[model samples]
Target: MFTRTLLCVSLSAAAMPLMADTVWMKNGDRLTGTIRLLDGGKLLLETDYGGSIPLSWSKIATLQSDHELLVKENQITGERAKSLLASDEGKVTLANGDTPKTVELASIKQIMKPKPFVEDFLWKGNVDVAMDYKRAESDTDDYDVDLKTQARHGKWRHNATVDYNRELRNDVVSTDNWGTEYALDRFLDEQWFWQGRLEYKRDKIEDLARERTVGTGPGYQFWDNELGALSVAGLLNRTDYEYADGEKDNFYAISMRWDYNRYLVGKTFELFSTGEVGKPLASVADYSLDAEIGLRYKVTDWASLNMKASKDQVSGSDGDKDETRYTVGFGVGW
Candidate 1:
């Protein structure tokens, strides 16, 4: 009876199957594969799907067996060695030659997913609104609301703004003035861009000034978002202005702009100066210098507010000796 019981136990142990092997990496990575070689501190492996892979030993954090196997005692050598194969109900030997403890493949937790080759794509836009009041040392109080929007996609961008104000004190002209401007930009590469813009102004006095500007120059992207970018564009401009008397003038200008995000939480600075040359349109000629400084605040993802103050000096006959304007407004962008 004792011999029969021992035979039954040995047969059961030999019939059990081994569990899968799991490989863990020091970089918090893991894989499941059969180790083919552990020579020279590196591992050559065959994954379960049958692909061969090589792993540097320096990159491995730990290795564990899935099950335990037992080896019988050798009476002649007076030594006992354990099997390295895993089993559901038996102890196994580890790579370190240590006797197996309870090891369960089903309990191993996956750490993280494989790293991606590219990160997220970003998009952004903003609009602003604000009120502006201005008074000359000897003129009536003028007030206006300003609106601005900035938008961007990939490496391309655009910005637009408008102002509506009561002319309160200027003589020779009515009490209302409105003006608008637009610009489009293209990023040539990671560090440079090109841009163009158009601007128009109208007063109740039936007088108008229109400008079409196009220039290709380098731009530096200081900051940016999905909707727009803050950059400085060096520009060479061609401008034409028309008066109520049907007189017109054209000139060249050099300009630079500092733009902010649409969200209205940034600042912008600009400088403009025209060369002394005149286009022979309507025999009208003029040269001007202009500068602007502004600030914007984002009210939300869709809307924002901004304020800008500008100074201009024209050194030609039939033009203002000098003019200045302060503006504030709000706008929305999709």
Candidate 2:
């Protein structure tokens, strides 16, 4: 009976699978996990005990991936090569069986799809809702909800966002605004992409009832890495606007858009800013500007607190056509 028990225990132990990835940290720490991906200089490592860890390349001294990965060599213009990865001392040794190619680890633009068909296509996004309620002699309320997502498949990428908000003071509605935006990108090279964008918005307080815009442009990604990204694009838009007074006008304009984002403190904090300026080719003075700046403080893996301020300015409108808003809220997302 003792021999049988020992034999069964040994068999079970031998059948268990081990983690396929190992990371050696620069400070002499070691970790074992399943590697989800390596993108933009960050590695997604899923561990049994710690859930998912976002480990930057800078923190990693060496790594070994048991499975093969598709690698993009620091430039989208280059073709992807499949290889088993071994990293040590700032170099990656690729195993393709013909000849061993050693490349700088920093020269790898991205790596993904270790299993061929599964991880290359995936979707990830976050949803945030913030609100405040106060009861005094009069009741006050404010709220905003935002949903954003990005998905990837091969060389194509899709992004979308939806926003809704409401504000009340002294039992009177002060502001109500909502909008939806969708964008698609087709990457032609590492730094250049062709994009199409569509936006629709309606604001009751600003008396801007309806807005529809369609634009196509060339975008340049100045930087995308572990720290963050900055992208700028110039687009020609056909815009149609309607006022709450039932007046409407349509025009064609050239617009410049800039988006900047950064992650700090081990991805626990975020700062972002985006702005757009439009100049009507027919009426240059009839230009407009819109901008927003926001900060996010992550409270946990799936929760965050956010503060945001935004400004909207429109030209040739009657009676103080500028609107500004400040809001605070918390959100939960995965």
Candidate 3:
């Protein structure tokens, strides 16, 4: 009985590789791992020994996967397959039950594991905090916190963000502000969507004490993938502003908003920018622009070091405001 148990355990260990996804290279190399996703001509494989490795789609001779995945072809729609079977060079067969379909790998646009249920979604976000303290001649303290998150399910996507900043120099408060925003997008097609947004901001040290905005418009998603994403929208907004002196102004505005991010060097570094520019119709403000650009260096899978510069400007208001800030901080992302 002891000899039989040992033989069974050894056989099970030897059979483990058969269950894993695999890719064969033209140079006669074989890799066994869990296939993560394919995007932008790169296939990501999660390996026990090497972590996540990205292989060039062009260099792969053949591949197979044991997990059900959604495979898109020619940048069009996709089909779900129970597993992938290696066929000839540069080809794969999608095994679904009794009916199997073979397709050229070069025509495959993207491949990703599908969520188990319709209610499942993909969500990612990050939070960054920056603080500075100095004790020389004068004491200075500055704190900035920014949070952003987004979730997508089926045709609907949700986004929310919050920002807070405070600075004190020589025990005197120089800046204090906070803002929160939420937006929802409903995709009409592959690249078009409708977006509705609401925003509110408050400043304790600026002439503009409070601001609120509501807007809706059409947006275009340039592209979104594991590497990065870019989208732009045009909006018509109703905005209300209150001054510190108890004065209020309301106006209608047309604005353009953009959000973009790109990952580099195997996703170890990211460059991102997001902002909105608007022109008010009633002359409440000649033009208003709020924008931020930042870079992040991934220290680990979930931790990062980031540097950001942002500008907020408003002209032709009762109290014109213009401010620029720079921050260096650490963040956690998922």
lDDT leaderboard ranking: 3, 2, 1
Per-residue lDDT, model 2, residue 196, is 92
Worst 10 residues of 2 by lDDT: 1-10
Q: Is candidate 1 or candidate 2 better by TM-score?
A: 2
Which structure is stronger by TM-score: 2 or 3? Answer: 3
Cα lDDT tens digits for candidate 2, 198-267: 9998888876687888998999988654455688889999988888888877788999988788766555
lDDT per model, in order?
Answer: 0.48, 0.73, 0.88
Residue 113 lDDT in candidate 1: 19
Residue pairs with clashing backbones, model 3:
none
What tens-digit string does per-residue lDDT give for candidate 1 at 1-334? 4335334543664576534455555454657665443333345455757564656655654453433322112211211223233333222223326543433322221111112222243333333344434456645555565555556666666767776666555432234666777778777776577877777666554344343444445667764322234567777767666665777766666656565433211112112121112222233435455455665554543454556676545555454435577666775545
RMSD of each: 20.7, 7.3, 6.3
lDDT of 3: 0.88
192 in model 3: Cα distance from truth in Å?
Answer: 1.6
Of the candidates shown, which would achieve the greatest TM-score relative to the real structure?
3
TM-score of each: 0.45, 0.70, 0.76
Task: Find the number of clashing residue pairs for candidate 1.
Answer: 29
| Model 3 poorest ten-residue lDDT run | 1-10
